[model samples]
Target: MHLNRRHFLGTGIAASALLTAPTVWGQAKPKVVVIGGGAGGATAARYLAKDSGGAIEVTLVEANPVYTTCFFSNLYLGGFRDFESLQHNYDKLAGGGVTVINDMATGVDRAAKTVTLAGGQVLPYDRLVLSPGIDFKDGSVPGWSLDAAEKMPHAYKAGPQTQLLKKMVEEMPEGGVFAMIAPPNPYRCPPGPYERISMIAHVLKQKNPTAKIIVADPKEKFSKQALFEEGWNKHYAGMVEWIGPDFGGGKVEVRPDAMEVVIDGEVTKVDCCNVIPGQMAGKIAALAGVTDDSGWAPVDPATMKAKADENVWVLGDSSAQGDMPKSGFSANSQAKVAAMTIRGELTGSKTFPAKYSNTCWSLIAPDDGVKVGASYEPTPEKIASVESFISETGEDAALRKATYEESLGWYAGITADMFG
Candidate 1:
């Protein structure tokens, strides 16, 4: 079945309603330290506190007091949503019994089961959950690094980068070129780069109709390729060009200072550049010694337990789980399973089999949305997709509008699920 808004919301709420655990007595509560405050960590931390009912002490360690969701951030570029709408706070999580710490976790002494924060606090955890999301691989993009982001933003992480990219787009010279260097495979949000292209095209179409968009993608094909291509042609005709590796799209370098792009040794001056480089699990996971050489933490398909350590669980964009895309929905689904397993292990609560589902919605134009999703089950090798669905090319406008409406409901429901 499709993992629509209603189904997603129902499953999440049902998971929380499973059972109230017996409170602990005459003993210190088992502590769970959750790193990162995105969909995965936030939901995991909240669920552990809510269902365990004082049996498990859940502490969430996030650098930022308020989280700006990477999901739907492209819509902000398209002017479909305001920047403030993307930001969420930990006030509700704290009210829900989660110890929300606003500090950076700089070190993890896994052998001692302690996380050292930059503020000089060492938090002990019976279980450590890492959902720290993606960090760019240094030197992944030649001539571009974190320092260059000020000139050519990689709005992949949202917040200031998102705002900067939007500003650059809005301030572009008339009929100017907007170039994007897309990431390689296995990146967070498979269709993200393309959706962002569509949203940027939407903005350019309205503000600077003659502006051009060029995408330098390493991959030959992408998720929802047909759907996005159809939307681009129908809505932003003659305004977009896609250069794949077949055309030297992979051989790319940027001069952020000069605002120039080198594609296949051919130089092109661009008004704005968005460089999305290769990515890996956030640094904290590697510091915890759970991530493999691939720079991603591998987890058991059944429980999201880190393959390198029994006490560590990896979720969201950081985990090298199979089949499921690194999406907010996927992270949220994995968190529920991890929360349930942790509760059962720590407090003797009833545990259920892990069933994961995810849906990724991309807005191509106003009221024009497309999605790809699947339901997943764990096998010996990996978490495999059991069923899948996608919005087809040439879908009716009303259906696309309904799909967009569904995404709005999902955003409201998911943020509530994460924060409250």
Candidate 2:
């Protein structure tokens, strides 16, 4: 389990890789360990190494070698994209001088400032960035547990579960019922469930037009609600049904064994069920003692540094910073600020005022996209929204198509920025 000098340097990279930390220089380098390789962690790792120009040793710890992006998994379900198009590997990060380790972080010793991997390798770090994404809150939904995921797939983390959900949708019997148990607010990707509904409807429209999709939501309103409703009526009229909290959307339970969903004490048989439970910061954040009582990690709005631990920074869906939603764009924006602050503290790199931005784009159907976004700055109390914009309902098809294309460009640019 010991990572000898040679093995540590040569295992995931070339013998002459810059990830070796300039051992010949006879000076200790500040080691930065980033746990999680999603939008936030990967970008933080890449920026830390690139902006530092090899002055610091950066190690990225990820549980998966290839990431399946949850942001656009809906598109894959709609058949607009393939699974391969959604996957990005870590070889580019490894080649770019980051010590990319495909390992799960099991524990964090704060006083010792060391991270323990599931394989028993311990990594010492001057600073740690934790962006492990979201995990379902225990018992958030009655009769649903992680053990029940295979039967009623959440598909919230992407990858295999996404494929499972898609397959379930595609294999639905003619005129079968598809049901979704939407999560509450303050969860990752505010517009994700609705977009998912649109994609599933798109699939059913083509494969089984008589099939029906149902959404039992706890919230009275959702992101882009007006736009989504308009699109649903225009594109998939009478095929999709949304029951809000006023109609007892909040009271729901599922019996995965019988493939039944209970809304407001009324049981209905469903051919497929996607039970998205409440969420919290990833397990590693709690393991590291960074999360607060709210089941999320609180961070300084200015620098994304963990309020509980100065040596730690939490990003993405794991962070409960004020005002910013837990989207990939928000995480990427926060990571840049945190990366700059870390560089400034360790390498004396000049730091600027922390400003962040995020834009979440969703596809209603093929060539129809809508978006919501805002610019923000760190205030004394929270990260406050500055200026905001959203796509209005009834926009021209050309504009919607343009918005979808814009999102495609962002995906390409952000992935390149994160991976390389």
Candidate 3:
């Protein structure tokens, strides 16, 4: 899709709705500080500012000036999209009344209700929204550390690491081996690693047909396992190999310097390796003392409010809300409910019960796209899935093409909903 300033302006205007009329404030406006500017925080910051109509002060603290979305970064690896297309700036957000600060949040004081930045600035807020995404667990993957990522890229965060992985894949030997160590359960984007494998296979099919791809997955079953397996067989048969727990995939170790992977007590030299380590909530959340021993913050399903502190809210992958996959779609859906609730609390506006929905689309090959989605409603216990749908295995090419096109539209729509 073509993007221009006018298109973004139009989309931004269309998404904006005034939730409450301009109110005369007796004192200073209620301050809202949002950390992380991905799907959840950016949408929440934008909506809170757009809907509240200057009634709430929304300051978005993000470490990066330009955000590269992890949602469609796989398409970039597959040669389906350019790296520039995956990037977005916050200029539009700044112009839309959000105070966009390009600085890292080093500390959060819950009792003081303030955030300290690496630049030595302290920001006070009446309400705080933490959507800081994920961080890798130390020593989760033996012999692999953040420093070792230079040799074996995770490419999970979708920035420099992604580019490095893509470069490595493109420059592989004609018939070299490429191995991937898939993360454990409850990681970001359940289908993400598999989608990446599909993209890598697509590239290998064109440039290096003799090349082989091996995946060591710890999970017994993954999201859309049957569909991915079917696609691998159909589009890139005999080129991909999957090792599950029954085959000792769970017992794995990697040596970045030697470029070797030990699977089930067998060492294999690989030309390239993708090591996705275990994950936890972003460090800032733990610093704020909202995250539990599980390495995720528990929140109220209805309002996305942190159960430990009502004044703080958590969203997206960092949240331990049940039944929702940790995808960009889920984060955006949760942000809307959280934004509406915050607006009501701060501006005395009308509020509605939270209803959330999400759909994740994965491209198997050129026009062969499949999807899985569900609608969710908050119960007293957790966010429960109400209804769900998925693309069938025997779907026609036309239908799969339509699914791919639908995913394209969703990409455009969601990024606009996010950055605009």
In order, what is each prediction's RMSD in angstroms? 8.9, 4.5, 8.0
lDDT of 2 by residue, 1-420 (tens): 445743663443553355566555433578899999999999999999989999889999999989988888889989999999999999888887899999999999999888999988999899999999999998888999989999999999999999999999999999999999999988999999999999999999999999999999999899999989999998999999999999989999999999999999999999999999999999999999999899999999999999999999999999989999999999999999989999999999999999899999999998999999999999989999999999998899999999999999988988888887
Model 2 clash pairs are none
What is the alpha-carbon lDDT for the whole of candidate 3?
0.93
lDDT of each: 0.93, 0.92, 0.93
| Range of the 10 consecutive residues with the lowest summed lDDT in candidate 3 | 18-27
After superposition, candidate 1 runs with Cα above 4 Å error: 1-27
Total clashing pairs in model 1: 0
Could you tell me the TM-score of candidate 2?
0.95
Give lDDT tens digits, candidate 3, residues 1-420. 223533653454444433233333223478899999999999999999999998899999999999999999999999999999999999989999999999999999999788999997888788999999999999988889999999999999989999999999999999989999999988999999999999999999999999999999899999999999999999999999999999989999999999999999999999999999999998999999999999999999999999999999999999999999999999999999999999999889999999999999999999999999999999988999999999999899999999999999999999999989
Across 1-420, the per-residue lDDT of candidate 1 in tens digits comes to 223533664565565456453232323468899999999999999999999987788999999988999999999999999999999999999999999999999999888788889997878789999999999999988999999999999999989999999999999999999999999978999989999999999999999999999999889999999999999999999999999999999999999999899999999999999999999999999988898999999999999999998999999999998999999999999999999999999988999999999999999999999989999999998999999999999889999999999999999999999999
Worst 10 residues of 1 by lDDT: 19-28
